[model samples]
Target: MTRKTLLILLVSMHMIFGPHSFAQQRTQKPPLHAKHWMAITGKPLAATAGAMIFQKGGNAVDAACAMIAATCTMWDTLGWGGETQALIYNPHTRKVVGINALGVAPTGATPEFFRSKGMKYPPEYGPLAAVTPGTPGGILVMLAEFGKLSLKDVLEPAIQMADGYPIEAETANLIEREKERLKQWPYSRQVMLPHLGEKREAPEPGEIFRQPDLAATLRKLVEAEQEALKQGKSRKEAIYAAYDRFYKGDIAREIVRSVQEQGGLFTLEDLARWRVYIEEPVKTDYKGIEVYKLTTWVQGPVMLQTLNILENFDLRAMGYNSARYIHTLYQAMNLAFADRDFYYGDPYFPPAEPVRGLLSKEYARERAKLINMERNDPNIKPGDPYPFQGERNPYLKLLEKWGEQQKGAAKSDSQESARSNEEFEKDFYAGTTSVIAADEEGWVVSVTPSGGWIPAVIAGRTGIGLSQRMQSFVLDEAENPFNVVAPGKRPRATLTPSLALRDGEPYLAFAVQGGDSQDQNLLQFFLNIVEFGMTVQEATEAANFNSFQMRSSFGNHESRPGRILLNEAIPSWVRAELRKMGYEMTFAARTSGPINAILFDRKHGTMWGGSSNHGEDYGIAW
Candidate 1:
């Protein structure tokens, strides 16, 4: 992330509710070895390594398993033991099945759990904040059901990486940033604590660093699984034992003990009783294209809703990169995000708050009405449902002030407006990395791994910090319609992987891990391609903008003054036009998340894959 975004995040964290968030990211160029009928991810070296597993007869699923496993080693910025959400594109069925390998709130979880324990919502860094990790569980389940290779094959690269590598520019920076917090974990400091009694510097650009313990863990999984198989255990049994070793087994117990020492809440039972959530992925149709996203417990539906609102218009007619087009997108995002904040929550445990209705044509049409081709509604508020139905007036609400700001809508004065900027500046600090890939067998994968930031690394388990996802819950149980804090209820999330289909056939598998920025970029990128008919490369290269003041689930725009940030690449003329139309602007060419995408042009029978150069050069192999 650029300095501008980091500044914005500072304000958002303080004013947006919940607590401040930490970021973990890397910009290593992905290795160039996955172009030919193979699976790939964010890190070139890691993805290339996984693709090699594919060449060794591993299927696409096995390859993803390998990439994620390897990623846990080299990409320590993201937790070696965190959660993930996957979108599996199956060609034979021409249908997408969402494998929700996300972590769940503990059976003992509740909003008051933190409040009572004096543990703030964002529990700085500890087991109290950690949800059961889903990366290991999710990958294994996915591989066993869809992949043809064994666990050992999937885990090899990660094991090698953990054993050792030299520090690179990105990794070096991350370690330097977290050095203080990492001192507590022997394994963590052992790997990140620079050289022999000397400090480590940023690798010139692409350098390597190794983690022996992490390597040992990966090796343990493969070795134990291999032994289980030899012991006459069935594949399922062997896989289960492998998972146990990582979680309930020695490794997991060691982590649990360390967490307990740090006054954390992960119990032996919590680890033993933990289970992954399984739910149906959501589906929607926009611009004659069928789209699928994770269930509403995430931002994917809003992506669909935002697209639906844009579908009513021909973006090409608006002209590509025109100020008018940019303004239109901002308006659509503002409206869609309004619904997202109001209604989106864990369907399993919605807050008592009124149920927000999204994806309904009636709901979307009402949102589109707010868009004015000639004007910018900077003083934006959720408009009545577009294609307005006077009846079925569903009431959706969000916190406006500490007091009774919830009675209805409240207007902000010049003085109040000035304070909005101070409050929302915190949302800009997010940093993340993601990758997208597909193999010849008609399988596509996307992995956006983030958690365990640099500052307050986790107390134990190698200086890991739990993901800040717990922030998705509301303090007032009554405010959340479908988001009531509860045991096992997954928080509504922004990290959703997406798949786009042509004539109902899967053609695109893409994902970006930008937290709040994810929705904004996804909206612009998809609309630029679907409605405007631009290629994936063109869409990614085009300039993008986000309204920091725009109201959404993230909170009110009042937190920040009239601020809408744009990429430096956008022409001055366009910026001038937007300013004329009433948008306050900031500039940053680096804010656009590295959008990794694979476009299968069935019409041409070729795979055209490209990764953004905004922060990292993507790796493409064939």
Candidate 2:
């Protein structure tokens, strides 16, 4: 159908079925003949932007980049100054690529700096935790390397969206939740809150929200591209120039000035030297499907490890969301996370084992033996992931020393439950928005853009906010050598997004916005489709659970043992059985995911998409 005809048909449908009535029906039976592509995003407008890009003859990477930019605009918490990590599958090569756009700590940031201030850890909010912005670099690099569209073309939607957009109910609630923090800073208040004669208040839904300063910042990058173009640079070079402008030019200078002036750790050198690296993804095979995630720097490999361990059991036989199934899954995840706690860290650091060891089938088999279906394993410990048969391994001394250090550093068992409860109550949403796109050519991309929440102190007038990622670093330098704060080191992040391939073809692309619960949610979403035979929408809406027994990814890395939270939708009998089995149970108001997913069924030559309908998240298939 022509664009005009499609628009008319949509309008007519809305009129005939009533606004949103068609959407309800669409969820019940998602279209199987979306001719070109399908997309899901944290916001409806972002999905619309991706659809528009596809209509404009752009590819999946182009649509994904555009959707992410659009998401940053409508969801102010995740945009230019935030971090973006993506997993892209190129069908032609049948290979998946990973983007590590997560920011690194500045040279000026150190554990001693906070210690000198008489603190055990850095505050979760404000300048001390801020890292160099990574989204601009990630977006520009993706456009230059993998995309078919120019920077201007992909960024146009976000720039327009930044100028002004109607505030949705969820956005309004988010703003209200952060209003008190926003008021603490003048620039943040101006940008995020409603202005009424110099008094700031929470904005209502449907009110016009404007970010002229953010728009100007985005436009400035476009101007840099224009300048490079006029100077006879190719489109690709112009895109790089825009990146340079953000990191090495005026934008960097302003960020440095504001951050340093406000007593933060960021410097011009930090911005100038920062680079977003593209690396090989970590992969594992589960029931013939290959799952791909970004490397161990983030918590991506944990999913691979969890899947590997779960691969040993017949989850389908155990029954979906049954007590036995939940118990087995929880045990597997707990064991996997125990390894994650001790082994997962910056791969560049000392004693870092090859990522292959974490995903190895042999290692998974050994880890799977630790699970006990009848009872929860409260005293979990990391395993020897290294594959070796020698009587005495060379690294045994280091491992012993590491184990002793962790034992000394860890809090007593009696104090663990209280600390875990406090951590859960304080930090739930660790700042993220996700977007996924797929095209006719079978290219698929999943990007999780995060950070720059109101808790993150904004740089003055630059409309660029810093990331509080420094909190993810470890303060106990003696106990945690791999995750310690270091100059130019990327913190171990929780911003994991994933893509799956079936028989060497693109199958699914998905991600969620919760903090430590990301991998758990992704695993369930994957199973809900592949194991339960649910559509994308059904998979997303399926009941979800998370085991908070592992250490958090936020400040101080506090751990809680045997704490399992199940969605209210899970049967009451299952909860009762879990509690009887010694699992500390809590009924969550909702699941840990506002999961956004896209399923590409290459056999049927059809694409399916879904999003969390209860929130601002939306999806479009066409």
Candidate 3:
């Protein structure tokens, strides 16, 4: 056998014969490669689903759609009733596209509307936190534009799995943890915490956990497609029938009724008017590798911007995971994140901030110049991107208090305000799930589908739960115009996915599930490969750090100032050096998630895949 063939055979043998106890462990994984295709996801079942689709004559997009649907069904962190963002590279066209499916704020959801309710920020749970459903619409768009399978074909696995599948131990624990919260709503409790015998606790790890309601809901969409086909509609046209059923028909009506009855502002028009958009991706060349991300609407660009600044430094020379390397990494991230917090928003809206200027190499150099090597700086603010580009500033003040200028609704007691602030801080860190797939045809897709952490509220009997995406919006209208709650506006999302192209060919398709720590982790992952020359598994398994010094994208937008978080596995010497540099260091057992990635070496015509050992992340190359 050839050396590569022998390696694959040995790995397969080990997988089959090794102790099964370590199946749930991540640190034991070896780098796996295949000649044709690969898949990875937060859950093993999802990865299997994607591989099955690939074997059944599906392309990258088709496999991704199947994998996304399967992951949504199995993982509560990201369910079918949420939002998704994708970065796709079509090798045939040599074009990279950003598929943004972030739902819009309701037309009636205004600052005054919340002010009238005597609250500054929106509620974390209930109808007030929902936006129009986007996942179903996004699926249809992907199927129509790039997929080779019919809706029925791609969705069958997910629908069947939803009807009946064994719950993982980790997922069962999550259900138990959120049982009380899920019980707050009868519809949610019934759908999630179904009775198994006399008790209402979470099901055991290997027990079959079925969501008949969700299965029925998915079947209804499929039924719509079948009905359209019977009426002589084209396959594409039939797909739209399924889309209409979700957005413009009974599903939309059900969602609106549940929302409005609970004091929300959703209407049929808001649902009907919403549509997913496929736009060009924003990119920057890093060491001859072109990195791409979604524009300002989400935090994807933060990675691109940070990379631009780091490109100037010989990161390898600084030494991997060294105090100097780690310090420089955070300093670069702090600067990029500061700009992201101040300027990133929906580019479709008015008061244009410099998205282009922020990604410019010259701008990165200017921002990098501000970083000091001696001590950690906490007071760093947003820079003048427009000034660098020779344009006028969009706002009089870059940073504005969201509701400070607004009439303080009914002047609550100081204690009440303090409680409100504490509650806001508690709800910021939500959950997410991601998938990466590559096909023999050279099409690669990296998708981060999220928004189910607050699935405490169910939308009536549609078997479809809703999300708290509205919490992503800033109630303060003066902060960032692109992020303010407004009609037809996408909330500034922290769900970011990434794609890299080397020499104009698909190089890497990767994404992570760390709420606000996603971009920071991704920056480290990319460098671990490009700079440190680590294998895909080594890159993913390496210890990492995060700086909470900047404001988080989650609830309340709180900042930790100079606080830094590192893994306990990082060298103690590095940690001590960081402390010496004036950083308030905190240690965690581990930080990298559920990171799923696939890298293609076009020159050698081979693919390598890696999935983080943390949680249930799984990968397969064949």
Query: Which is the leading candidate under lDDT?
Result: 3
Model 2, clash count? 0
Per-candidate local distance difference test: 0.62, 0.77, 0.78
lDDT of 2 by residue, 1-622 (tens): 9998897666544322222234343453243346588777887788888888887888888988888888777764564677899998877787899988888888766788878877556668777877789888999988888888778888888888888888888777777777787677666777777653444376778888888877888898999999999999998999999999989988888888887787787878888888988888888888899999988788888889999888889887676687888898888888777677666667665656456666788888998998877888877676676662222334455556755654444564335435556456356457788888888887889988887765556677777767877787777644445677777888777888998888788888889988888888889888877776667776776668888777777765665567788877665566788988898877766673788887876667888777764456777777
RMSD of 1: 8.5
- The candidate with the higher TM-score, 1 or 3, is 3
- Residue pairs with backbone overlap in model 2: none
lDDT of 2: 0.77
TM-score of each: 0.83, 0.90, 0.90
Candidate 1 lands at a TM-score of 0.83
**What TM value does model 3 have?**
0.90
Q: Per-residue lDDT for 1-622 in model 1, tens only?
A: 9998896655433222111122321223332233356444556677677668867887667777777666656553466656677787766766677777556666567767767875324343545555656677777777776777788777777776666665456666766765666676554565566453455532334555655566666677777788899999988778777778876887777767776685555666766666655556777777578888886677677688777787777776666556777787787887766566555676555432222346666677767877887777645554444224334434434333322432322254234344444345443334345656677777877666555444333435433334545555555533434655566666666677788887876667677766677878777777656655556655565456776543323322223324687877565567788888877887776655567677777766667665766654345456
